[model samples]
Target: MAMGHYVNYYRLEMAQQREEEGEEAGVKRSAQYMALLTGPGFTGHVLALILFLMVTSSVERVRRKGFETFWYTHHLFILFFITLMFHGAFCFIRADTPPYCKSSPGSYKFVLGSLFFYILERTVREIRARLPTAISKIVLHPSKVLEVQIKKSSNQHGDGFFRAKAGQYVFLNCPDISAFEWHPFTITSAPEEDYVSVHIRIVGDWTTAFAKRLGCSFDDEQQFWIEELKNRTSNGVGGGEETISGVGVGAASGSSSAVAMDSMAFGSGASLMGGAKQRASASANSLQLQRPTEPTITLPRVLLDGPYGSPSEDAFNYEIAVLVGAGIGVTPFASVLKHIWYSVMQPTKIITLRKVYFFWVCRDRDAFEWFQDLLIALEEQNLTGFLEIRSYLTGELGKEEMDTVLMEARAAAAAAAARHFRNKHYYGGGGGDGADVGNQGFEGKGGEGDLLTKLHKPLGGSGAFPMEVMLGEEMNGSNETLSDARRDRDAITGLRSPTYYGRPNFDKIFGELALAHPQEHGQVGVFFCGPKPLGKTLHRCARKYKFKFHKENF
Candidate 1:
């Protein structure tokens, strides 16, 4: 559309030059004369063209990298639209006849209504976003995923709280980070929850910087663990409990121990308050935890523009819903699943769907930490057998990685035990008196618990071990095939459903769904949020199975 408009405008300029000058003079100076016509109309066209090219080029140039570049360039639309109102003001395009062809500034008239609405929309959004919004909480998960919880304060009348349905999104603008940049993120928290939350994977510059500002540090070489080991040999003041936050974040396969950071500056006056253990305790099942210290940091002001509708918002309308997410694409499904859990847990709540199948395909096992707790919570309720979750890890976990996790677990357990023994003899600390020092090595009922259980913290008492141990060395018969299979715990996620090694077999999955829900069950709705290629594959499957398909338009 823009190209066609520009082509016509260029022809009009040529015609106008011919009328102003003689045909002979126009032919002699067509290019120079056209360039010299620096009226508002011609200048607007040029500016619009430049803005269009810059925006399009920046999107491709950044690829998966520079988010700031794309964000800044995309805002050129404001200037582009302003220029467009004057694009044909001078009326260069002359009619065939004379009297009807008088130059009149009518371009603005053509766009006046739309421009008014556009301005009005932005004005309303800006005013609403600025109204007393606060960052309630922030959680830094593995794989550089940051979860932010936002709370909206109501007016004096106790009205105007932000309301949204499941599978919706919001435009977030943090002025402390960037004054003009606003990014859209799926709302992972359900409408039933009091606060709105979003899970952001720290991939681009804006996101990486945002995570760091929220108290997470990144490292390429070290796997940072947050362990809260209560020191028995306390300070002379009172032996009060101390909480330390770990600074480094890297791949889960790293062998190095955690790096503890105290008084780490995050936001303005903000310090690290809770350890990862406390953070895990405050997952989807739990939202708040009492910290030992009152947090002094003032969280950055974040403006939110929406709880906008999305394709996945229509998920519950279907009798059978198949939700497919890839990596951070699982964010939208988080809301869907949470809403489903709420609906199922409360019998009075009405929901259209009778069955749901959620498939998450991620590259890293640690990435599962982003939404594993929510999935586990839903699983615990059984949801009346209405929901099924199948997770796939496309990335290969080599044997060496498994061995490294095992070694790290052993080292951590040994270190904790050594501390316990040292404290017991030197500080006269007693064992099993319910102190953290005493239970460091024996948190589980059985022998030395593995790091997998510690990392994920499954709801079950006897959680998963890193790997199978030798015959006599096994703590609770970890080598028994029947018992291990019965445990139904993935070594990585520690969930009842084991994570698949490679890509999911979509054909088999679709075939089973088709067989299970025949035509009588009504059309199955397949909602997906992922890359274009996987969406295409799913679209094909949907077509072959005669199901409705919906892909999120990010």
Candidate 2:
């Protein structure tokens, strides 16, 4: 009886273990299915989450302070949390499925690891807010731009100068009695250089003061003579007697510039008194204790935000690249050109890029002169042969000139489309299904034939009558045909033919470049950072030429 009982117990244990394994397998399968659905196929879900967040936030703000103040205090956290939860769910589902699990256990581990990193990144940002202030010193002094240099730093041995890409900008802060105010200035230095610099045009209120404060003068100058006379009288023997004598001398030198110079000389006296008074008053004002001394004009505390941009090295792989900049739009391309030069010319890893064209539109020579040195240096490196620079002045692009440019661009696009169509028919195997080839076919009737052959037919490719095509015929046709067309007349009359107007033909540029350097390998990638209209035009043109385009907005 004891032996039989032990045998039964062992069998029961085995059965329980098998049941646990089955449950574990189901859990894994569920996780895997979730991941696959969410990965690329569930983009709609992500968009829905975004919309939900937007609506929820709007509703919450309306409840808080009515619609008038809703625009000011809408918390963005509603949208942020919605997206976070959706993204997390997406990743969780992708890790446990059959196909995903068929790989080694290492793949599952990687998904978990990425999730860990995401959590850590958020945690660090949360802790950062409680940290101490980053800025150490603030200066509020006026400085004139006496000279500008666009060369590498002299001291390479130090912590290495902050390297900047061509078009990136830096913020400069000048301390005032109120609070620190910062101005953004573009860096003219290329990425390969050790140091960066900016060229500033003295046009603002601060710049004007800087010029007056920092400029030097000769003693023979009217202002200097008055300053010397004042010093002499101040030091003369007998205080009461000297005071009378100073008044007499001041009366004699009766010039406005002299009076202005004297005022500046006395300005230092007031500053000294101000400093002393600030020290005495510090105990009463707690805020003064946090402020730094030395009254710096050029603040040493600069906050660098980003090396922000898309991949630049990818441009080297393209056969043809076109860069267009209007005014300051040239900034991002500066980084691109620098990347190309280093990647192609470096001895260790030489990648031969084919051709680059740059078109810069500016109002005056001064704009070009700002970064002309860098352009000249690039030309000197014998890179100009591979690069074309065209400048269009404001007046140079009038209505007639713009019209011509647009026409040329369009013509180029049409020609490229024609070539692409020809190539597809001859070499690339014709379209698998008979479809409308440029405003030719209607829905439902499928045919199998060459596109060119269909284009030549008198019926113009489709039997299911196009509403617009029948409109003119019906208007002039017999009364019987008009009655039949009257039922659908609105649809026919409303239809408008597609026209290519105010559009850029990017196909011409891409096709010409491709033809010029057929030996160059890899896919064409076009990057554009500009105004909306220009970017849209380039995108349309790129599509025509079959080149990939990426656009970034400022």
Candidate 3:
């Protein structure tokens, strides 16, 4: 009887537990139903789509006039408000839903749909805010023929400039002009530097205007003068044929070489030339050069946003690095090389790098001259042995010229090796037999000391190159001898052959490199930043070579 009573008590407890579970499940379902009714998930998504169309239509109108005008201003505020409303509605819905709702089968479907809407909304916002609105002080401004280097403050901590990896870009806002507009520029300085620098070439209206405003000489002034003339006519100079002719002649003549030279001298040349000639004609009947007494340069308030690019960490693991740079594309490589140099040469650790080849293409001697100092320093450090520096002067460099340079460099290297072998044999305790010592001496005796030395010495043989070669050869030999050593002690486990080529036909270069270095399949990475065609070609080549390609467009 007692056992039956105990069994009944257990049965009753089980039934009660089941009832509680059923009630809890019912409560959850009710909560979910309430959430679906109140939440803006579907409703908000529809509203966002409507807002996207509205914003896109408004953009065309905003762009037609000016991005800073009332139409643009009103559109921006309206878009912002709509986005906020949509965001708030979605948040309210998410909050009201039970946590278990997230586990429902339909949840993933909803999320996928919501994600698309989110991306679209965010993208539109980015397009609207394309112009950065912050201001950064100009740190350094260096003028070059093709571009100007403008260094400015960064978002990084401390007074020091942010360290940007190779291929990264920053958006600059000149608040002094319009706070809504921002221009993109790649960082050209080394990553270790305290200040960031960007090399900007005058290109479009915005860039050209910015360059002119920054006092870089370019064709922008002429274009600006033309634009100013058009503006005046549109503003209703209400005149007859004579007045129109006067304005046309004035604009044309004002943009002439004389005006350009005058502008360069006075710095206010654009403004002065842009003013109606009638006004100037009344002031003085004579053509005269006027220089502004006050400084004309008004530094724009600058703002920096983003350091976007592929990460540079990939280069750190590379045993051999080959950097191919065309024109200003060399900027990112500069940063990469700098990082490698510092990381490898740090006093606290000993990380040996095998080789780094830099193939730089330029248009003239002046182009080479720009980075000449940096190249010289690298060469002096014997870094050039590991780092081969080759320059192709594309403007005047024909196939023959390029071939000649390559031949000369190769012959110079071979001859130096031969002479060094002879010297070792003659001097004793060196690595050669004394076969050519007599011949060398005889050649040296013929009043050809300078010629013999030149022929015997390596190209750029100011002692650094030979020392580097010797050390490199020794290291290579040591690795061979230590092949049987423990893996931890192996220094050359993954040594790669050096890449040497001059003005390789871009069409076949990728395929050739890929075929020869099949092991590079997963290990190699390619970076291209230059003319669109060259960049595209490299991208194709990278695919053929089975290399990972990272491209940064300017």
Candidate 4:
């Protein structure tokens, strides 16, 4: 571009010469200037191009090795700006005067309005990000993603003085990692959550090193489950005060643990405040231990700036939302989804949301653990009709392989459920199925403790969708073996939506959504937070069919 501009400048000068003297007269220049330009300018341009390539060569390689290389090399743009400013300040020809008039061009001349503002913006950003912040929580998800929840000090609200809308992002600066480096991360926590949170994927050197500063890694979930099972074993005969009939063993043991936990909560927080233990006791079922078996490690300090708007924040404006996310790209949508959940959980603030369709596609089953608890809590809220989550596991596996994996997972969940129910029955009296024990009668039990009557059995008969989605057939005694097999399979992976294989068909999804909500009557907002190619596909589909498309590409 600079060469083109210089070429045009010479052309204009030659045209002026041709007009001043007849066409016979030609343009003239000093041999000294010509020699210098022809020799050094040619060499300089070539060398600059070579240097550019060298800096850009194997970007992925350098990116993996260190982000500082990418950062420092990109700063070479300032040198280019400086050279161009000097080049513009000097002119080789001038027809308006006998001698070409040249001096340092006004400093303001070198400053493009946008560039000045940009530099100013960055300066402000540095100061803002320098504001001190404390890391309240650091969750190392099973998928090697780090979520940092930062608490901002405020004069009021006790939550955060820095408020950010859903789908917005912020710049995180951890001086411990690098004093100069500032990384942008999408805010994963909803505005409803007091603190700001960012999900960082450990894919590059900077991120990997940053995550290590927390000094904790995600332990194997399987080991945790094994330890839990070991702890559930009865220490005394007759299970020492069993409660319910079928799931009594698991419940009674869990109750003893719960009482011990409540006592610990009260003891630990007794001096802090009376409400500390009460608050801890209230969330006993939240799965937070009174005292974590692993000691909590002190994490390094972090700083944050901004809550810049992204495409996803607009989703709240629409009545219907269809969110598609792939792997770690799902950060932006996490905030939106959390906002929706918050709306449902706290109904004081009116929410205009009618429906939310979230489709998350990841490569491995292990990735699902990140949001599994949140998804289950939302499902338990009976928002099935409002918020539909479609998760896809894209892996090369046979039909039998997938089913076998799901069955094993379900068996583990079932065992955990039985234990939970036993604890609930032993402590107070609520059934594990979210049913109130007061409604379940003990009139026939010789009052033999309280017996939890099973309601709407998935297996005990009464024809309830057959539990097995593979075969929709009404099974009779003739296919008793098949029925048993289906029931067992269904119990292994019950009501939770099944994970599908491969990518989702956008056409099928849009077509179904279109049929469900007419375009002429209602507008559908299709939100995508993923790769550029996927967004392009969605954009094409949205344009071909009439749905408003919004995207947040990382």
TM-score of each candidate? 0.70, 0.37, 0.45, 0.65
**Model 3 C-alpha lDDT per residue in residues 429-462, reported as the tens digit of each score:** 3654556433333222234422122223332223
Q: Report the C-alpha lDDT of model 4 over 328-403, residue by residue, as the tens digit.
A: 8888888888888888888777666688888887775445545554665677798988998766655443454334
Q: Model 1: clashing residue pairs?
A: 269-297, 270-297
lDDT of 2 at 29: 26
Worst 10 residues of 4 by lDDT: 242-251
Q: Where is model 1 more than 4 Å wrong at Cα?
A: 1-29, 36-48, 51-55, 58-63, 85-87, 91-103, 157-160, 219-296, 404-486
Candidate 4's displacement at residue 121, Å, is 0.9
Model 1 TM-score (2 dp): 0.70
- Summed backbone clashes in each candidate are 2, 9, 4, 2
Instruction: Please give the CA lDDT of all the candidate structures.
Output: 0.62, 0.38, 0.43, 0.56
Q: Residue 334 of model 1: what lDDT? A: 91
Candidate achieving the largest TM-score: 1
**lDDT, ranked from best to worst:** 1, 4, 3, 2
Q: In model 2, which runs have C-alpha deviations exceeding 4 angstroms?
A: 1-188, 196-296, 311-313, 339-348, 363-365, 395-508, 518-522
RMSD of each: 11.7, 27.4, 20.3, 12.9
Ranking by TM-score: 1, 4, 3, 2
Clashing pairs in 3: 135-302, 136-302, 136-303, 161-194
lDDT of 1 by residue, 447-468 (tens): 5443223233211134333343
Among the numbered candidates, top lDDT falls to 1
